[model samples]
Target: MKIRKQLPISALIAASALISTQAMAEVFVAPFGGYSFGASDFSITDEKTDELGSLKISESNHYGFMAGVTTKDPGDIYFLYSHQGTELRSGGSFSPNVITDLNVDYFHLGGSLYFPNGNLKPYVTASLGLTQMRPGDNYSTESRFSMGFGAGIEYQMTEAFSLFADARGYATFVNSSSALFCDGGDCLWSISSDIMWQGQANLGVKLKF
Candidate 1:
C-alpha cells in the first residue's frame, strides 16, 4: 500500500470543502492491515465428551483487502476478505496456556453508504458473510454464518487515490450446545455462546480507476 505524508487538519478540511462536486462511477481496491481483538471465549470439550475448560481467542494482527465499485449515489458496493492467525488458550485465573493455533477468516459481501464532505467522506458499512475457523492439531475446520457492521472515513488525496480507516464488529452464529471442530467422529470443542463476536480496525490506501 502507498501512504502519503500527513497534512495539517485545517488545510485538509479547508481543501476538502473547496473541492468540486462531480459524480463519476469508479472501481476501487483497498489493502488494509490492522489488529483483531475482543473475541468471545469458547468452551472446550475433549473428543466430543465432557467440558474440559474454557478457551480464549488471543488478540492478534490481521490483514485484508476490499475490492468494489463506486456508485453514482456516492457510495461503494464491495467484497471484503480478512484473516487473522492466533492461538486458542486454556483460560485460567492466573495465566493461560496456549492450547493450539487457530486461524479466523471472514468472507463477506458488503456495501458502504458515504456521507460526502467534499474530499472527505464518512460512511457506514454492513455485510453478511461466512466465518471460517481452522485449528491446528488435526482439528476439523468449521464455517458459520456471520455478519458485520462498522463506520469509517476516507480522505480523497487525488482523483484516483485515497486513504481510509474503519472499525468493524463481526458475529458468527454457532451451535453453542453441540460439538464443533470435529474430524470424523472426534470433536475438539464447543462454544459457550450461540454467537461468537470479534472486532477489527483497519487502515489502508484505496486505488480508484
Candidate 2:
C-alpha cells in the first residue's frame, strides 16, 4: 500500500509558478452589487424591556465595490478587499414602521491562489474583517469583529478583464453589555455577549490594470 501526501493549496500554488513572483503587480478593481439574507438574534435581560416575539427579517438587497491586486508573475500571491452595505427590514414585536429598517456594512480582505487557465479559474480564499450594524432610529449601532472562509470561481473575458461569483459566510462576536432598545432608550439590562453569523452570494466583474 502506498500513502499519498497532499500539500496545502497555497504551497501548491507557490510551487507551480502560480502567481507569487512579480514585484510590480497590477491592481484589479471591480464594482460589485449583490443581495444577502440572514437571521439576527436579540437578547433581553431581567430589567425593563419591550414584549416582542421571535422575529424574522426579509431578504435584503446590497451593493458595494471591491478592489484587489494581481501579480505580474503567475506564481505571485493575490489579495482582495470588499466593502458592502445592506438595508435590513424586520417585522414582529417592535415598531413595524420605524424599526423595520436597518443598515449593515461589511468589510472583507483575503488572499487567493489563481489558476489563470482560460475563461474560468478556480480559487480558494480566507478573510477576516468587521461589520458595523445600525438597527434604525432608536437602536444603537455596534461594530463587531468577523471572519470568512470560502472558495469561488473566476472567469476571464479578456487579458485585463474577468467575471466572478462567490458565496461566503461571515460572522463575528457581538458584545451587547451596553445594549439599548431599538424602539427608544437604554436597555433595562444588557445582553452578555454572543456570536452572530451572516452569509452572502455575489456576482460581479473584475478588471486587471
Candidate 3:
C-alpha cells in the first residue's frame, strides 16, 4: 500500500506573502501527539513468482518533540524525534503466525519558513532524517534515509503559547531486500524498497520563551 502523496501547494502560495518580511530570533519547544496512518504492504509469494499471501499494517498513533530557535525572518530550525507502531494484519491467506508488530522511529532536523509577526502565521517545512524500522521480534532494525515537506498555520494564543495544525507526508527509502520471515535460501517474498509512506494531520502546541 504505497501511496505517493504530493506536498500541499496552496499553503505554499499563502506562505509566500512573508518572503519580504522580517521576524524575531528566540528559542522554543513543542511537544505534540497525533493520529498517524501507515501505508506499507508486504506480500508473500513463491520464489518462482506465485502470489501466496500478503500483509498490511494498520493505522496507528504517534507522538514527538521539537526543540529549536526562531531566527531572523521568523524561520525555525528544530530537532525532532517521533515514534510509531502498527500491527500487521493478513491481507491474504499467508501464515496465521506471520502477524507481527511493525515499528518506526524518526530522528530528524527540520527547518521552516514563516512570517515574523502575525497572530495567524503560515509556514512551509522540510526535513532530512533517518528512519528505523523493526518488523518483528529478534530481527535486526532496518535503517533508511527519509525526507519530508509540507505546509501549515500557527495561531498565537498568548505571549508564550500558540496552536498549530499541519498535514505532511514522509517517504522512507527502503529499496529492495529479503523478507524477515524468509526460511533458508528459499524466501516466500522479496520486499521492494520503493517508497514506504505515512501521512499525518497534526494539531499541536508550541511554547516560545
Candidate 4:
C-alpha cells in the first residue's frame, strides 16, 4: 500500500520517537474485564452467477477484555490491548436455530496521549492492530480479519489510579458464505459473506504504577 502525502514519513518517524521516550518513564499493566452490547445484519446479492450474497448483522450484550500499561503521572502516554465477543440466535423455520456468534479479538499495541491538568484527563489514542470475527454453529464456523482504531477519555482519582471509559469501532474484511444443502437431488439454500462492521463501548479502570 502507498502512503499518501497526507501521512508523511516525517510524521510517522516523529510519533515513533515520542512513544520510545514515553516508554521509559513507568509502565503498569492492568487486566480489565467489561460487558459489550452491539448488533449485526446480513444480505444476499447474486442468487445465481457466483451464488454470492451479503450479510448485514449487528448485535450487542457481549463480554470484553483489556490489558494495558500506564505511566506514573496523570497526564502521560500508555499502551493497551482490548477484546469483545457475543452470540446471535436465528428465529424460525429458516431460522435453523442457527447461532450467529460474533467475536472481536484485538491485539492492540498503541499508546494514549493524556491531558493531566484538566479535571478529567482527556486523551486521544490510536492503535493499529488485527480484528477477527467468528460466526458459527455447533458444528461449523467462519472467521474474518481487519484493522482497528480507538479514542476516548480517562478520569484520574489519585496519581496512582483512576476510572476510564471509551467508545471504539472496528471495520472488518472477510469472505463468507452459507453451506449448500442438497436433498439427494437439488440445492436447497446457500449463504455468502457480504461485509460487516462492529462498534464497541468500553468502561474500565486505569491503575498507575
Best by lDDT: 1
Give the candidate order by descending TM-score.
Answer: 1, 3, 2, 4
Candidate models: Cα lDDT each: 0.85, 0.62, 0.75, 0.54
Candidate 2, backbone clash total = 8
Of 2 and 4, the candidate ahead on lDDT is 2
Task: List candidate 3 stretches off by more than 4 Å.
Answer: 1-24, 43-53, 92-98, 177-189
> Which residue pairs show collisions in model 1?
none
Higher-ranked by TM-score: 3 or 4: 3
Whole-model alpha-carbon lDDT for candidate 2: 0.62
Worst 10 residues of 1 by lDDT: 1-10
**Can you write out model 1's per-residue Cα lDDT over 75-174, one digit (the tens) per residue?**
8899999999999787733247986799999999999999999999999999999999898987788899999999999999998999999999999998
Provide TM-scores for the models: 0.82, 0.70, 0.75, 0.59
* Candidate 4 overall lDDT versus native: 0.54
Candidate 3 per-residue lDDT, tens place, 73-145, comes to 5678999887888766666666544466878788889999986456999899999999887767544566889
Task: Report the lDDT tens digits of candidate 2 across residue range 16-95.
Answer: 65444444577777766666767565544435555543323345667766677765434223334444443443344544
Question: Candidate 2 has what TM-score?
Answer: 0.70
Residues 99-139 of candidate 4 have per-residue lDDT tens digits of 45555566555666777656587776666556555444432
Best by TM-score: 1
All candidates: CA RMSD (Å): 12.5, 8.9, 13.2, 10.3
